[model samples]
Target: EVAPQCRTASAAGFFAVAMYYQGADHASFRPLCPAIVEPQHYVREEPLFSSMAAGERRAVRRRRLGWFAHQVHQNSRTLIGGWVTGLFGAIATVPMVARILAPRLTSQIRESMGSLVRPPATELHLERLGNNPGSDPESMGYSLDEMSQIVVRILQDIGMVKDFPPTIVFFGHGSGSLNNPHESAYNCGACSGGRGGPNARAFAMMANDPRVRRRVSQLGIELPDEVRFVGAYHNTCNDDVDYYDLDLLPRSHRELFRGIESDIIETRARNAHERSRRFESAPLGLTPQEALEHVEERAEDLSQARPEYNHATNTLVTVGRRDWSRGLFMDRRAFVTEYDPAVDDKDGHILTRILQAAIPVCGGISLEYYFSTVDVEGYGCGSKLPHNVASMVGVMTGAASDLRPGLSQQMVEIHEPMRILFVIETTAEMLSRIIVENEGIRRMVEGNWVQLAIIDPSNSAIQRYVDGHFEPHLVSDMQLPTVQSSMRWYRGQRDHLGFATIQEPESDQPMNSSESNASAAGALA
Candidate 1:
């Protein structure tokens, strides 16, 4: 049923259209629907019929009738002209009039229209001086005091600080090779006083910035005595320069320093030896089975080392083999279970629960996932490992609150997961052969026995996995061609790749027997 107000408004609109059409130009207006009566019915009959006197009255009557007829003809022309004019006026003015009255007519429609016309959200604004994109890092932007104040405001908004403060950490990165001009002066001597170079000066400037200092104070974030910075080198020959420059940062930045150092060391070590020989030679990977065993053993060792420290701590550990073919025959579930036992406990259970909840929100489980693969032969670490690890940590930290109330409350308190990822790159032909040559590995994932998510950033065999019933996803940015080009341009540069989490089936309900039967029948028949 139509709303009463809607009906009334529509009637008013129709009436307005009729009135406007009546006043419009005659030629422009035509009857939209057929007229029920002729024009003669509309003419006035009084004055023309008034003459009379007996026998003369009859003659008078005849004259009066003729006059009346002429009058009727004239009036008909006037009425027709009015109708045409009104029609054109109605047609021309309706849209403009509607727009003018729209706001008063429907508040909800107005709001929807406004939103439809609005632009996308803007990025965070940086308040700085000068147009120099490449200014001396220390001298650019607002003063250190200003930065501190801004930080304070952010902390206040987040409710992280009600005058409560947290420790502050500064991580830095730059090009620092023999080829660069400022290679020798790794630290910001200008920031520091004469006792050091700009290092202290830089920190002092940052601390002095009202915005920065206030934010730091509000967040209760304290900066350590040392600052950590990572410098990139052009070649392996310049490794020494990169190493020494790293020490220039404050001692407080030591932890940050160690992490980057460890990554570089690991990447270098991996690159030095042959892919086949490295596993066989090192105690870490003696055999294909042993390598798989090592991953499980490492998972346990790492889990034990960290433990579930508190209600807030979350952990993510990913272990991939360089040679998946070598472990093709190995039982994936056996290895995953042995290696990552924690996954079977509370964390895994909660993750599964969250997935179930999210399914309704996101529509379905056939979402795409992206993965990366890097050439192990290269001197630099590939994008796959770092990207996966970072993404996992981000998801755990970012979505912690959304998963559960208790988890959300412990968001800041929880320790981020320690991630381990592996990457291997080979030609397309070789990859195709590997899948055929190593059916065991393919079956491990396709059989749905292993609770793991595999992403093919390269997109090579990713479709095959999808076709085989494994939820393989392609992250377009991580495709082999793109990654290779990136590596070539920025070999030593640190870049984040993409990653997706491995989620278990959300519900305990078994697959429908009918659906399974249909699928089986379709396959066979």
Candidate 2:
């Protein structure tokens, strides 16, 4: 079936050749017989295709296409069309083109002229910024009641109700890579395959609203007046973070906010170093800056195969408080969503919301990566190398093949094919109810699309949900490699390492997971 079919029993520009075993032919031409069952076996020649994938094929194809498209000048129509358009525009549209570009040109010129002196920071005057009346359905355009509900729910989930952190950073995630077809797949799962930075920004803006704060007070979730919400975007590719609306932060909190820059730097470096271990080209024993530089360059490199493995080895989705796994080094695999079952109304209202959202988004991403890794040809686009961005819709193997689906081979090569272990901090009964209520979520659970774990709100007991019932997850207290920090753990190791706990650098500091949990619990109580 892979070969083209023959027709009309003859050819002018084509010839046919047949190779068969000596025992295969029948006795008489007029006599008919059933086809032979098996081959006696003879010679088999090596195929022309090397199975070279992704960047290799892309490098060769890009050069050949470049030569043909540019040096060879094959597409004369497009070149001549450009030339004709330019000439026509020059002859007739000087004023029109200028008019079109005037505002943009003026702005660019003004900015360029002002570049000598340092520009004062752009002030985010939220106090003066009036809310749009028609944007929201609420009478005030900003509903404090709804805002308080969302704010309180989020705060309670993270286990920081009474003792609010001076500056809480919401790190909405997304990825960056070059020549990758499944780039959007690496972005914030909750944002409908878009960048989550804007969503984070909106959430921060809502949290900082005084009007919303007053409403929150009425609801009994008293956020300290001094506490601030900072929205940030975490670049999953290189681990670089961009803080948004920092100028809006009160002047008193400016120094405290500035202090977080070092932590961000540390995080980026550590994450970059950890990721660099997976890449074949990255040198061992590298500093943070060097590691980050390599990754940044790797993403831009046209020939590099894996530009940051998107969600590879993502097996865990811990939906309890961040306290349970705060210092646990998950190799950038776990989706740690915060949710506190104790604070929410006993009907599993908040737990339902968290599970309903996280299950589908995380499950879809995990399953898609799993299937693609399992069967690249059947379930995924074979390699990004031969893929042409067809009409900016989907990719194609060649000019006339069917549009390929799912992830490319490069993205999922290291992905462990498994159902996502969704750890929720709620009762088993509550989880059962939530699953039964939402048909889509129920399909995910009952259909084995996602495995659910109901963590007891008060303790470390994790109950696994399977076949419409819950059983305790038999956790093995296995001995694994120990490291002080994530960077230290993954420093020189290339292969996958086992689970680990974050060892505190200082003796007086709190235990990574337990101490934080204990403090948060005490404060909230």
Number of the top TM-score candidate? 2
Per-residue CA lDDT of candidate 2, range 1-525, in tens? Answer: 000110001000000000111110111111000011121111111112332243344445545655765742444357776676566656555543443345334334544764432222222111212343221112112334555665665665554567565666665566776546767766655544545554445457768888888887787878778878876777777576888778688997776565455556765776687788887778887887788877766655445567788677788787776556656777767776666556788787767765655677678878988899899988988988887878878888977789888888888888889988887778878888888898878888888988877778767787888677998887787576667677667667888777787674653433333223221110000
Give the Å error, residue 292, model 1: 25
- Checking candidate 2 for backbone clashes, the offending pairs are 157-340
Shift of residue 94 alpha carbon in model 1, Å: 82
Report the lDDT tens digits of candidate 1 across residue range 425-501. 22233333434444443343344322334324244353222334344345567422222221232233222222222
The regions of model 2 sitting more than 4 angstroms off are: 1-146, 476-481, 507-525
lDDT over C-alpha atoms for residue 491 of model 1: 30
Where in model 1 is the C-alpha error above 4 Å? Answer: 1-127, 130-214, 226-267, 271-525
Candidate 1 at residue 10, lDDT?
5
Query: Candidate 1 local accuracy as lDDT?
Result: 0.26
